[model samples]
Target: MKEIVQINLDNEMDLILAHKRCMKIAEMCGMASSLQTRFATAVSEVARCAIAKGKDSLLVLNINIIKATQKEITAIITDNVDLKSCSPDAFIYASKISHHIEYQYSNNQSLTKISLPIPSPGLLSETKIKTLIDYFKFETPLSPYDEIRKKNIELIALSEKLAESENKYKQLANTIPILICVINERNNVLLVNESLENYLDKPLLSFDRKTLMNFIHTEDIDGILEGWNKAKQNRSNFLGETRIKKDSNYIWHLISIVPNKTEDGSFNSWLVYFVDINAQKMMVETLKDNTQLKLIQHELENANSKLRFKNKELEQFAYIASHDLQEPLRKIMIMLSRAGEHLSEDQKKKYYFDRITSAAGRLSNLITDVLNYSRIENKEQYFEKVDLNKIIIDVLGDLSLVIEEKHAVINVNPLPTVFGLDTQLRQLLYNLINNALKFNAKQPSVKVLHENVPKDEHLPIGAENYEVIAISDNGIGMDSKYSNRIFDMFQRLHERDQYGGNGIGLALCRRIIENHNGIINFTSKPDEGTTFWIYFPKNKLYTAKLSLKNQSSN
Candidate 1:
């Protein structure tokens, strides 16, 4: 009698196929056909259990078919499983079927089967039982680490995905647009993107440190050196404007080379993004030429020529208007003087001829102010070192009549020797000091002082040397609203007959300060004094006196 071979099936599909093939083979070996069909039924039941509880694992079943005598075969099958969770009725039902089968296997796996096959009556004939027993005696059970093998497979899949992503990141870095370049801290080229290859018309691998500097323009070499030195010393990002030679043409580029630092605050490399700024540079050059520009004498001459033509027209008009009106005003004044001689005391009281005489005199004064204001600028003249103290003294002497009339106090401080036209500075002092004297309230107290400004006491608006001269006065102060208008010509805040003068004084002051390339601003309040501060920039106008000082000392 031959022994039936032992067979181990890993999973449900393997077990079902193996059982089908063995059943067909067992019947040919003279085993009962009905009992072979019973073995197929049992294998199908185990397959359902394997599918329900095993996600990535499988069910293992061992089967043995034995032949004891011709036409007698018995099968013994074992499955590695547990069924503690099955219902009591199901267990009772399976136990009943186990008693009827020639060889019984328990349904202990997680799945529930609808039916268990019963062996045909007298079908097995006890031939397969002996064969199945011999199969179990030679084989051992499989180990449990088979499930851990699946976990290792999943880990390898994740590792492969991570590697793919890293490669993609490097690929994108080498292909992005803009003039991308990576350089080491020593300014050695590390990588260049494909967009830069398109611009250079060369392959990326050909770009290296050996030929990099040769592409830069010679005129920008020094500036580029200074920028690189600053980056290395400061360990900071370098941004500069430079030109490059490409295909025998120069292109301006704004390069932002930022250092990528190591952990210890030292740079290991740099990232550069170059932007073409040639169009913007050319636009700036065009705008500079368009402005009526340059400190050159020719442009100044052109400006002076325009001013001379306008001034000539204005002076002639003022002279003619003043001459024609003065003649009629003289005749009216002479006739009024004679009329006063003829009228009696009562008639003189009825007629006010003095009003007409004063009105004509005011018109004449306004005309004179308009003429002087229009012709204030002498563009043909040059600045010279002039004693401003002498100018102030002359102004004080010119207004001596008013000082005596009000018994007003006046103080003149030592002034600087500034380089300016004497005519302009003289007019500046005359207008400002006269306003300080004329605007006083009942107390007619006026003081003029000058002092040197300290170097650091300035908020520089532009690049220039400035001297701050504060002209303080004790006058009838003005409010904020009227203070700005007081400098405008013919914009008087009070009636002329009351304040007693033409309003061109402050207007003339503003124009004179402007002609000297200076600014005149003031601070005032109601019932408080006013202080006008003049900011005169130091130029040939102010520094020429230094040479005179040394020569005087010698």
Candidate 2:
């Protein structure tokens, strides 16, 4: 007698769940360790095939018993899954591969060889086998479809062709002296190519199908099981890294398992390959220990800032990197403006220049912004306590000339003091004000509002004090879609001439806020004014908030 069960789980996680459910049954059945392991491998192969084929489908499984002196379990699983155009025969042929097990007898005698055909994907071995053990009865063979044989030949031919193309693989394996062996789902060694002897360093019998798993490194056992389980249920190949214990140490190897199935969809065996990557592993360790080399890339921002220090020396450097990018930009603006000037009384070039100049100017600005953004932290800068209101007032006063020229309406409120570099804060306020006024074609209205929400602020609570500095504006609002990237350097939502400034302003603001051990984020909407909220935390080592602003304001 045997038990039969079937399940159809769609999600990858669901497949994992089903596999676990099956393993639990095997444990409950109190089956022999070897047989329990075999059951697990059987369930895994079928489950893998189910997920890999697509469209969350169900697997139908039939379980039966073969009885002589002892009872042996047999199962046949099938799926009604409609798959994409592929050779059904190929999948079936891959599954038909049988596994050989040399069983251990309790008496002081010899072992017996047993050939067990593994179950197909989906049905959990624990469920069916335990059910079979619970109600034992004799039954005829639950034979597989005979017609699948015709397709198996075709599948074998195709698989051989696939493997044959790797004609150089064996030669390379031999030259490298790498150990490569293929094992069945039960971890029974089906075949070990000539190149594999080097790693095993043992006789062929020691690494045969019966004892194949013993050679696997203890730490890698779980990983191998995981990958195999995934492949069994989902119908996929497993490739991963593991270690093989040798002389009390581990030798790392990259192991791969590919499933070959028969035409009737019986998993035949696994094709595994291994490669020794000791040199690469050593290189990784060397880099991990090199502190200076590790920090160099992160410090590139500092180097770039020094490169952009308004020096005549770097003008040529930037010229080389950007490569005369500004020239074409200037020429386009000139040509467009000139063409507009030369047009007849009826025609206007300002309209055309708006689009062309905007495009060229935006491109030029993007290049400049990228270079400048990369250079901000390269140069040394000091930090101090800064009064937010003063920075706003200073920027407002600086732009007073432009404000009056454009008849812009300005609204301001008192702001709190923060610990940060003055120049950055001033720059932050300037960009906010600039972006606000620049994007507006009508009214030219701008309002700067401040709020203090220190403790209520969403900041990493690692310091004594936390301050939230919100810089909200009332102007032609930006789209909320760009709210996330509004702080990204070179990311502009409008034309350059339409809003004349490098887009690095917000990005710089973010860097400054982060340097102060603070957070910076935004909330905005299309046609609704945007608000950039910056957080500042008071800590001894991280004091980026206000000194520069205080000194300048004082």
Candidate 3:
């Protein structure tokens, strides 16, 4: 046997070169033209398969001489790739072209060999073989058939990839919340997701540009066109708010258009999405109406003005109350569902159950706070000479268990008596003391001090003197930036997980102080401590009358 040629099959060009060389070798062996074509076709197919599925492949051509009686031409394609994994179609095509085709595997290499036998008298002469060898020295022209086959394979692979991409696109568009539609450059709808069909109450197959335009509100057509034109000119996205007809009623919808362009920078299509914005639009309108109403009623009678303001405040409070309450209820439901799953595991069950219990306790506290806030003005008026010392003592007794657990110390500085509602004053002292104790990191020490401001000290009118009560505590204080915000309902400074409270303690105290015609203020530094000052006016006439009434009743 003699080696005719050896070529590395690394790419398409290498495969073509191998095929041409095989054909020329078969010709030089004096094989028939038909046999030459068959041998070359088989070599081309096998070489392509090896290059596509294998790594570092080589194509070898050899001459076989059997005892000077017979001569044969053979081509072998070998690579370090799995032969069983090669496409069956390539092997089938090669087998049809030549009966001497066979696959061999040895030394961890896959080899496909094809042989063409020459007749005894048809063996090539020495001169003709040398000429063929010289021809092989130059590059061979690519076979048209092989070129077509390569193109066909590429097209098949590309088609499969495109189909996969289309499937993923459909899945994403249908699963998302927004309505999606694809439109071609001719203004014709090409595809729409199920969301669009559901929104229109009709199948998308029956929709076109005209049909879609009919469903849009008449006033929005010009705006939509203007936005679309701008998007096209700038090659950017278009966004606008419009109304679309659904169930014979118009609803606000936000439309977003994303332009798709071809490689030549020409328009190809557009991707449009619709999002429902009726709730947001309605909220804006409601706020506008409320502002206008308030401005119109500002000059009304004092009684009516107060009533209107109170009504507005109640409305706002109701909105906030419902929203805040839902948070805890949602947590309770989620924890309960999780607890049901871990009922058999005692530790897991207890963990989730404790969370559910905490959420429920928070819900209860919020309801109680809201109830107390609402009843601040509804309580019967009962002003009397209330002793601050007695109120503080009662509050301390009520919180005795917490005080003991925290190892808290209480200091008093002769709090003066004042004319106010006894129950409100008791609640005010309780909240302030509880806040100081709850936020403390170390053993809490609280001081209750008071001083009487003389007449020249500038107090509210109709007051002989003002009693300023200062309650200071060593606790985990907060930044001064949130000093005013601390009195807002549901405005918590720390995360609920760190400091567990409903954020209503200070608000409740503020309300209670306001009912007694007093003002409350606070000062604090982070991690240091805080002090709350309450100013209560002393009205001589009211105190004297209340004292006389108390004497008569006794």
Candidate number of the best lDDT = 3
Per-residue CA lDDT of candidate 1, range 91-151, in tens? 4533342332332326442433222232332344345445544544554332222222232
Q: Could you tell me the lDDT of residue 166 within candidate 3? A: 47
What TM-score against the true fold does each predicted structure earn? 0.40, 0.36, 0.39
RMSD of 3: 25.6
Itemize residue pairs with steric clashes in candidate 3. Answer: none
Candidate 2 positional error at 299, Å: 20
lDDT of 3 by residue, 371-441 (tens): 66665662325777899989998999999999999999999888888878888888899999998899998
Task: In angstroms, give how far residue 281 of model 2 lies from its true place.
Answer: 6.5
Superior candidate under TM-score, 1 versus 3: 1
Q: Rank the candidates by lDDT, best first.
A: 3, 1, 2
C-alpha displacement of 298 in model 2, angstroms? 21
| Best model number under TM-score | 1
lDDT of 1: 0.56
Name the runs in model 2 displaced over 4 angstroms: 1-320, 327-358, 378-381, 384-390, 405-408, 413-420, 440-451, 454-464, 476-482, 490-504, 525-528, 543-554
Give the whole-model CA lDDT for all candidates, comma-separated. Answer: 0.56, 0.54, 0.71
